[model samples]
Target: MKRFWNWNQDGDQRQLAISGVIAPDSWIHDNVSPQVFQDELNESQGPIDLWLNSPGGDCTAASQIYTMLMNYPNDVNVKISGIAASAASVIAMAGTTVSMAPSAMLMIHNPLTIVGGQEKDLDHAAQMLVETKEAIINAYELKTNLPREKISAMMDDETWMNVNKAIELGFADQMLGDDHQPTDCYSYSDKQSDLVVLNKLKRTSQNTISVKSLQKRLSLLSH
Candidate 1:
């Protein structure tokens, strides 16, 4: 895999899928890069199905992606099938509708950093982190309607929530497999003349759809 994160439009361009960590290409493995993310976001149209299974990384990257999703022209549906913790949780907050798999987990906490500097530098760093946390809280509050104090306390405690707990706390709007079906899908067939699928999901991995795959798909469509 080129990276853990993958971005691609589903068949018909009605929906898109964004999977894996939110900050790939960082020193950390299994993360999404901000540049790649922006390119993907720019090309996205209509509704998007963002499948998140991440441990999170690079708060700044997550924050930027969050803003991009929030500003998208159409709706964004975030589906968490594994984990959306730390900065990934922040990105989840941008979803127009956030759903968690029955067994998925969500976590929230204060931003972390490594610092080596004078007292003034330390103080400034603390203040910057506080602002970052507050910004994160804004995203959460928009979805959960929870007070800032409550959200902050949850962060302070490093809270982890499952599906039901997530809904109870307003962290998630619904459970996966609710009213909306999985919106992201693909199509492929060994014989173009028979068993043509409109939209089927393989979901094999969080890896980029290879160019060969796209070409094959187009060739099949043109036949």
Candidate 2:
């Protein structure tokens, strides 16, 4: 994953280029230092243009970046160049004005977790997930002015919105530039491999016998 937010300043103009993954290991965390942000803020005399192109990562990091942008003194304009999914959506809403390229996509979904724990721990985890979901819904409602219930349902369904749909939903404010041909990251070969693995797992499970049946047979043998 590549991630980085670049701050460029020329005389009175300033812009921040944000691209790639939004995780701890991404370019944003590694290359975009706090000093860079500060320097841009101090030197720039104009509004900041934030160009975003990301697949989303690290909720906590995205939240931090969102807060930073929201609290910035100057105006923030976000231009989505590609896809902004999950936590990236949150950061996009931090901008004073959000613009998406014709080919861009916006996706939202509930947080996910995989846990191995006792019943009590599992219950607690479920509760935490619910609360997190509610929080994410609240953010969407605040930005889009849509009903929380509707937003919550969309999140549950893992909604994927195109640029036009995003604009209609109020998630995107404007469409910028001409549209290009859409390309899916996953190839046909990858899909075939996934299907083969799934089929093998299904076959293996189908061939397995229940332990309860084996135990009953053992009891009969002992008699």
Note the Cα lDDT for every prediction shown. Answer: 0.70, 0.68
Residue-level lDDT tens digits of model 2 in 1-223: 3336777775665778877777646334455544454455566447778889888876656766776776666567788889889988988877766778878899999987678789999999899789877877766765676789899889989999887787667676667753231212212233222322332232233336553454444456556
| The best candidate in terms of lDDT | 1
Model 1, 98-124: lDDT tens digits are: 778878999999999889889999999
Total backbone collisions, model 2: 3
Model 2 TM-score (2 dp): 0.68
| Deviating ranges (above 4 Å) for candidate 1 | 1-4, 13-21, 24-33, 180-223
Runs in model 2 lying further than 4 Å from the true structure: 1-3, 25-45, 178-223
Q: State TM-scores per candidate.
A: 0.72, 0.68
Q: What is the lDDT of residue 24 in candidate 1?
A: 52
